[model samples]
Structure formats: structure tokens, C-alpha cells
Target: MSGIKIIVITFLLCLFIINSICKNDICINKSNGFYADYTSLNCQTFYFCFNETLNKTLQCLNSSEPIFSTYRQRCIGVNPLYDECYLVNINENHENCAWFSVQLSTTSNLTYHYSCLYPFLFDLESKGCKHYSQVQCNQRFEPKDACDYHHPQIHSSIDERPCWLIPSCRNKTNGFHGNQLQECSSYYECKDERFLNLTTCPKNMHFSDKSKTCLITLSNCENSTKF
Candidate 1:
């Protein structure tokens, strides 16, 4: 192909990829008005489209309000749950809501911790961390497991990465491997070092990485203690 034609094709391909993905692209087929970009665990990025063309792509950065609310159709106040939650200065005795981050290989949101500082808790109304005494949000004494934020079924229109991209099971010759982001209850059994079979534990049992088996006893999975 001629160089000019090749360049044109490359550009078109990029656009196609963008439209296929959610985070970087939202101008699919004459989109007019604002649309949310489902990226990095939240619908933050804003896109302005009209007549099958994207006019602007905006970000909620360098401002107090960074979270984009689709209901409001605009950026809102400061979001304490903006990114990864961390324990910078924690009080060992204090009961606080701590969060753990879980990375998904195929999801747009790699992971984000949503815990407030030591003395404060995440306040939904204020849209930021505030004194725990004033906020009615649920409080936990300890941070939940990373798997708590994950779900076994990823019902997304976007394409998921190949099995090779999965770090835990990529090189496994055989045996079950737990997916931390998909909760510990579900796991993938690797076979012949090249195939994967999705497996879930029997009801009331969760997969256990420590013992490499499912058991009726509680395991460190989402709400396992409840069972």
C-alpha cells in the first residue's frame, strides 16, 4: 500500500479502537451531548459529541470537584473516594472505614482505595472525608479484603484481555489459581499450561488459596463471615 494510504488506514484504525474502548473513546455513531467515560473505576471523563463527531474531551482535574455525575450531568464536589485509599496516619484503636484496592486485568478501573484519613470517614453527602461523628456512612474497624470490590462476572461490552495476560495463572502448568480481583470464592483451574476453566465453589463454601480447596468453613472472601 502507498504510504499515504497506510497513514490514513492507521488513523482510522485508531479511531475504531477508541470507539471500541470506553475510557478513551465515547463518540460512537453521532453522539450528541455529554457522555461518561467509564475509566479507572469511575465515570469521570466527559465527552462532548455532536453528529457523529467528538468536539471535546474533558477531565475533572486541578479543581475541587473531580467526580463526574451522570445524574447531575456535571462535575460535583470533591470526592474523597477519587482514587486509591491509603492509611497515611492511622490510629490503631480507632474504628475507621478502610479500603483495599483490587486490580482487574481487563477492567478499566485498575483499583482504587476509598478510605478516609485516620480521624475521618467517607461522607457521601459532603462528597469528601469528614469527621466520623457527623457522617452516617457505615464504618468498619478494619479494611476489607481486596476481593471485596470485585465480582466474578464482568458484564462489560469491552473486550477482555487474553488468558496469557493474567499474571497468577499465566505460567501455571496445572491446578487452580485464585483471582484476587474476582473475589477468592471463584478461581480458574489451569490445565496443560495453556487452558483455563472457570470454577466456583459450592454454595456456602469459598475457594481458599491457603489450602487450595473449597471448604464449608469461612474463608477470606467477600462476606464469607456471613456464611
Candidate 2:
């Protein structure tokens, strides 16, 4: 065969090999949009093709997973801390409400946290992120395993109450019961009608009033304790 004929045959063979591999391993097609529902079997590699041409090869970073966004026409990382949640309008129609779970370190302990995309809240009961109106907002303390804020400021007197972040304490009426003291947890209570008081956790530790326990930090209270 002539040199030109041999070159043409080689080119055709290369094209056939590439087409076969793409057809078997990827979901991209001629009619595919900017992005396609294509992920590697390893779940850590993905690709973005433009105009039927492989444009980019992206690898998942850290603990993030690689995903393709049909709306964005690209590859993205589903990072817990930096992931964006899609927002639903006030009407609460059928929409995607994606959320990410993040691990955060407080002064005392390591805690797992979840953030819903805009206008959504993480539902503990459902174990899923849902629309704000759909979720039944907990008006009470979280379970003992969760991390919650502890107020550390010193009050002027026993009559003066500090403010914590739990919902039950916020709803309690000041001086409703005798001495107006409702123990939310061993380390915290509702006092002075509208105020919350921390009994054990110091300024440096996070308090879990539900378990009546205090999370200790290296800076101040070096050990977790119960009052």
C-alpha cells in the first residue's frame, strides 16, 4: 500500500478504537448537553465533554465526591463545607434541596454538622435536608451526641440569667414555676422567666444541657465533667 493509504487506514483504526471505548465506558452521546450523567466506576473520576469532544478530566479532591451537574454543564465536587444547596421558592414546589454534612471542631469537641441549601433546614427526625416549611422545627434540645452552644458570660446575680441557643429555654416564661427554674439539662436551666443559665460548662467549653454535661477544651477546663 502507498504511504498515504497506510496513513488513512491507521487514522481510521484509531478513531474506531476511541469510539468503541467511549461508547462502552461513558454515557456521552452526540445529543448530550454541556454535561452528562457520566461517572467512573471508582466514583472518584469524571469528565466533561463539549461538542462530543472530551474537554476535561477532573478528579475528586480530599473526601469530596465527583459529580456532574446537568444544569451547570460541568463537573463539580460535592464538598460538605463548601457545597451549595439549591433553594426552593416560598411556594415549596418539587425542587432539589441538596445538603452537605460537615465536621466542625469547637473549642472542646469534634461535631458533625449539616447545612441545607438556602431556605431549608436539616431535619433530625427525617435524617434528611428538607424545605423550611416542611420541617417540624424542634422546639427542644438536640440529642446528647450533638454539639450545642454554651453561654459563658458571668451574670450579675442568681436572678440574672444568661442566654443559650436551645429553643425550649427561649420559649420558657420567666418566673413561671416556683423559683422559675426549669432544668433543661444538668448543666443548663431556664431561669428568671426568659433567660437560660449554664451550671457546669465554663466559658471555654460547649455545654450539653440535655445530658447535663460539659465538653472540655484544652484552654480552660481540660476535662469533661458533670455537675
Off by over 4 Å in 2: 1-112, 140-227
Enumerate clash totals for all models, in the order shown.
Answer: 3, 6
Residue lDDT tens for model 2, 57-146: 665555544554432333566644432222221221122222233323321223233333323344545444444455554553322211
Instruction: Please write out the lDDT profile of model 1 over residues 1-227, one tens digit for every residue.
Output: 69999999999999888765753334544224565555533555767766556777887674677666532346767545432222132122124342222333333444533333333344444344444455563544432222221223333212234422343433454777665555665666654442245677778776776678876765445322211
Among all candidates shown, the one with the greatest TM-score: 1
Worst 10 residues of 2 by lDDT: 143-152
Which one wins on lDDT?
1
| TM-scores for every predicted model | 0.24, 0.21
Model 1: CA > 4 A from native: 1-25, 29-31, 78-227
